[model samples]
Target: MFKWIQGGISAVTGLAEPEYGESHFHSSTKRLTSKKVNPYTRAVVSAGDFDFQNPSNTNVETATFYINDLETGYCGFAQIIHSNIGITTTAQFTFKLYNNNKDLGFKQIWTSTKLENFEIVDKKNFKADNLTLQWNEDGSLRIKSEVNPESIVDLLFKPSITNGVKFGTDPNTYYGPSIEEQWGSMRHVYHPRCQVEGTVTNLTTGDVIEMTNEKTFGLYVMALQNMKPHHCAKEWRFAWFVNETESLVLMQFETPKSYGNSIVSQAIVTIDDDNETKVIACPCENDLKLLGQYKDEETGWSFAKSVDYTFNGYEIKDNNVDNEVITDDSKAITFELKGELSELIERMDVMNEIPQFVKNIVSGVTATKPFIYQYFSKDLTLSRSDVPESAFRGSAWIEVTYITDEREISE
Candidate 1:
């Protein structure tokens, strides 16, 4: 759940004009569907897409790396979470390691008086405490940290798809009563299909694993969410599904009912090429549907038992120059994962993750119940429309979130 409400209240208290509330949002999808933007066009990707934004403009920013596979049978993610609240700026380095069975991890937080602990050297670099993330001159990403004793970070993410992906030319969604009265902004950029090199020690077992790019893969994400949680979104759904040669990823969030409860999502599908420069990254005109959901007792939120993801868009027919970007609308790509989720990894209470001050302030005003359901699996069936029924050993990490109830989500 997004904390958009807090930001809205903050702006009001600070005497900012053009109040943000019901009927204020201008959704990106609304723009995309207005006939002005062609949904079937190729995604406009760029090397500059990874640039870091000014921290003062947003409350939270993160550079996260998700390890898709490891020859030693371990996989997980590392994230440097930077947050600005009131007059304090804090950075949290968190990592979780998982295998085919169990999981382990650690998170360490460091706060600075005026962002003295965090440093931004340039477009491709930033340091939050002992963690250093930078892009190399050779189109690779280096993430190193000396923040702890239990887990050490020294990893290189070599992009199989060199250019970062921005779903559309605009690159951001503006929300408010109008463009001039913008109350919030949402942006995301993805670095997918990377060959990860280097090693990170196990969080608990203390075992050292040798790392190489040949058998490993991961995704890097740069995200900015600049509003109070509830005022921004009611739910968020994310999925990263991959095999050796391809991947399917979706990033989505829904505005609260006050903002029309609009759903905005981005989907990407990529096919591998041994030559890094030749890989194909496709941005889909997509829709994701949740099926057969039931109410959970603990969170009182619905859990989706099945998912159907449809990717409709053009693709590079082949490497041949004459092949052209083509699509068969009648046979748009589709995939579904049904039945039991492979593994119920974790159930998170969003309130537990926020600062006590913010918690106290929010608890006093409105009804806010936020929970996240996370699932992970090393082996899950991902079947394309035309294939060997199930063609590959796919790995996935998915999250579904539910926040306060203003209006019930029908689906």
Candidate 2:
């Protein structure tokens, strides 16, 4: 049977209205389905499907592309979000450009209409107005966006490991076991490691920043959430560490107490040596620990700067598992983050970025104070079981939804 946590503390509490329907917000158990290839990908074996449609008020889909160039100390992040809540829908695009001279340029453009312009031609292709995202037949991805006049990003993602990783209980299910499904459904897939190349052009300044493959690393993610954001998770932690020899991506989140205080964590580790690439997938959360948290003065949210985790690596077969564990103590996967809070790249009050109507809807439903903080770190060291110790010089991003903090709510 599909096991789910029983009620403890309701994340919704008095905020939820009866009109939203209790079936959409209650926890229930069901029989676990057998592992099979995702029906959405039965005809085409691309990176799953991008055409996720749900009429619920909390349905949301997003695509994010991030690149970090170690050689020139430049980084770029571009994302698009399509959120449909109740009778209204919103489409937003955002871009951030960090230059070699320590300059950060950011922009966000949105429209409540014109959502029809966003298209998913197939499981591997997507387009939004002037922005075009495509996964090539050879497994590379081309991402181009001109949604903002001030900043235009044209990038390419060439995976070191052509086959990306999928996180779910089985091929038929994409979200795995989490509180997201108990209340609603949230799922994610990622191309964890890639060689990135492209350019970020500033139209107003008529300047162009070239991103070459020399030392440019990237991570691509596609996510879907079918419930109100605040009701699904209370906090989130994400980071990517890339050096000359390896790339590591970590994602962890805490479900609201309504779901038994469960935590979901996943990691992808990629190593490149002598032109050979090895991708390790940690599909299960076993003995995972996130500790040592300090509150950020600016955001007023506690975040962990370190992590201790262990998982059984597996080689996926036929989009399912054969119950085989692929890692041992010597070659097992572990991650550690120790460093000074180097440079704060960006801190965003997410609610402020959305429309007031949507903000009211969120505030009316939950006491969520959502904030996102992005950082650049150069003082940390990363060590793994199979690779030599290396400096964890890269970027880290954190998102927190501070609930029930009167101070934050007042602010």
Best TM-score among the predictions, by candidate number: 1
The candidate that wins on lDDT is: 1
TM-score of each: 0.80, 0.74
* Model 2, CA-based lDDT: 0.57
Q: Tell me the tens digit of each residue's lDDT in model 2 across 198-308.
A: 888877878788887578888887777666665556676676777787676766665555444455566666667578666544434434444577887865676555544
TM-score of 2: 0.74
- TM-score for model 1? 0.80
- Model 2 segments more than 4 A misplaced: 1-57, 100-116, 168-183, 281-299, 302-323, 326-331, 355-365, 385-411
lDDT tens readout by residue for model 1, 1-411: 134655477464221122345457765545554633322222222345677665574367778888866454556777877776546667777776566543433222121112237776676688866778887777888888767655677999987754666655555677776768886777777776688888876455566655775878888888877665565777888888877777777788887666666777776666666643332334334567777778888767877766666655444344223213233342345544333466666777868866877666554444467788877766655555544476555777888987766544221
